[model samples]
Structures are given as C-alpha cells and as structure tokens.
Target: MTDKAVSTIAELARDFGVTARTIRFYEAEGMISPERQGSQRLYHPRDRVRLKLILRGKRLGFSLAEIREIIDLYDSAPGERGQLDFFLDMIEKRRVDLEQKRRDIDLTLSELAEVERNCRNRLSELAKGREQA
Candidate 1:
C-alpha cells in the first residue's frame, strides 16, 4: 500500500535466488531503486516487483537494455498499453530467434550424426581388412 520497506536486499536476494551483488547491479543499472537508509538498502514493493521482472526477463534471454525499456514503459505516459505492446513484440522476436536457433541446432546434430556414422563404417571396414589379412 505504501512505499515502505517491504523487504531488505538480503531478503530479496534470498527470495529471488540471486546474489546481493546482482541486486545491487540492477540498482546501479537504474532498473530498480530501493530506498537507501545509510548503509542498508530497503526494498519496497515496487522495487521487489521490478526485480522480479528483471530476473524473469534475464531468464527469457532479454538483454538489460531491452528489459529496461519494458520497465521504463511500465512507468511512462503510455503505461500498460505501451508496456504490453512492447512486450508482445519482444516475445514474437524472441520466439523467432529461438526457432532459428532450434533449426541450427537440429542441423548441427544431423551433421554430427552423419559424421559419427561415417566414422563407425570406416572403423568397420578397417577391421574387416585386418581380419582378411
């Protein structure tokens, strides 16, 4: 309800399964701004939510710049519509990129399998020639 201390940096790191330094890095990157009280940093609900979004975006392979755009859009004049539209576009782009990666990986695996089969057949032929000798 208020911008009070909902969690400390350590608490957020423990809950989010990230290191304190990582949270600090986000703070430094202007992604999330926690309230600073002398030596201790207190995270409010907004900070917590933003941290969650940052982690999720990272897991989804989003760059820090892309994630920042989404987070900034959430607070800008366009609000949720801009945020949602941008996120949708990002999702589509990510999908296409991942699909291409998948195809490349599949092609690499097929080539590897072919190489392995050739290697085994060469080994078999060598063994047969030795036995005939």
Candidate 2:
C-alpha cells in the first residue's frame, strides 16, 4: 500500500477541523516537526500521524507534557517493557481522575436541581401570600 508523502498546513487543518494556528502551536510545542520549504511548512507522514496523536491526546484531556512523554515512549527502544508499563499506569491514573470528575459533576448537578426546586417552592409560597394580602 502507498502512503501520503507530504501534507500542507492548510490541508491538515481543513481535514482535522482545527485552525492552522493550532497546528503551528503544536509545532512550537515540539509535538510535531515539519520541514520548511521556503515560506511553506511541509509536513511528512510521520508529522501528520504525530499531529493526529497530539490532537487526540488533547481531546482526551492530556496535557502537552503528558502527550510528549507518551509520544517519546512510542519512539523509544522497542524492547523497553518498562515504558509500556509506565504508559499503562498513566492510563489508569487518567481514568481514575476522569471518573472522579464525572462523579463530582453529577453531584454538582444534583445540588443545583435541589436548589432550583427550593427556590421555585419559595417563589410559589411568596406569590400565594401576596394573593392572600
């Protein structure tokens, strides 16, 4: 099978639904490296895949540093079992954190609903009192 040899900034941005500035920011952060052809930045297939990973990581709430670490691990020695183990540990931690956040949000929404109900009941009582007066 053949692969895409190169990609332009505009093409990738359009395909990924992100702005060119966002892709440039990732380049600045050392997430992806693209070759410069005069004033144009030409992204290789590797860069394109890296960008995909970076965007996916960002969407999953990973920090740039965390994403970089994971990407670096992917490029490290193939026999490094410890790196894979570390990545697994990181995934578990992230899962736990996200689950806790979900629980907190649910609790917050429940509290808000209760507060709204109380406020509505108070307003209804106030309206009844005014009518009786």
Best candidate per TM-score, number? 1
Instruction: Give the lowest summed-lDDT range of ten residues in model 2.
Output: 78-87
- Model 2 lDDT tens row, 1-133: 1257988899888878889999999999888999999999998988888888788878888888988888777777763475577667878999999999999999999999999999999999999999999
Q: What TM-scores do the predictions have?
A: 0.95, 0.83
Q: Which candidate gets the maximum lDDT versus the true structure?
A: 1
lDDT by candidate, in order shown: 0.92, 0.86
Question: After TM-score superposition, what is the CA distance of residue 38 in candidate 2 from its true location, in Å?
Answer: 2.6
Compared with the true structure, what per-residue lDDT tens digits does model 1 show for residues 29-96?
Answer: 98989888999998988898898899999999999999999999988978999999999999999999
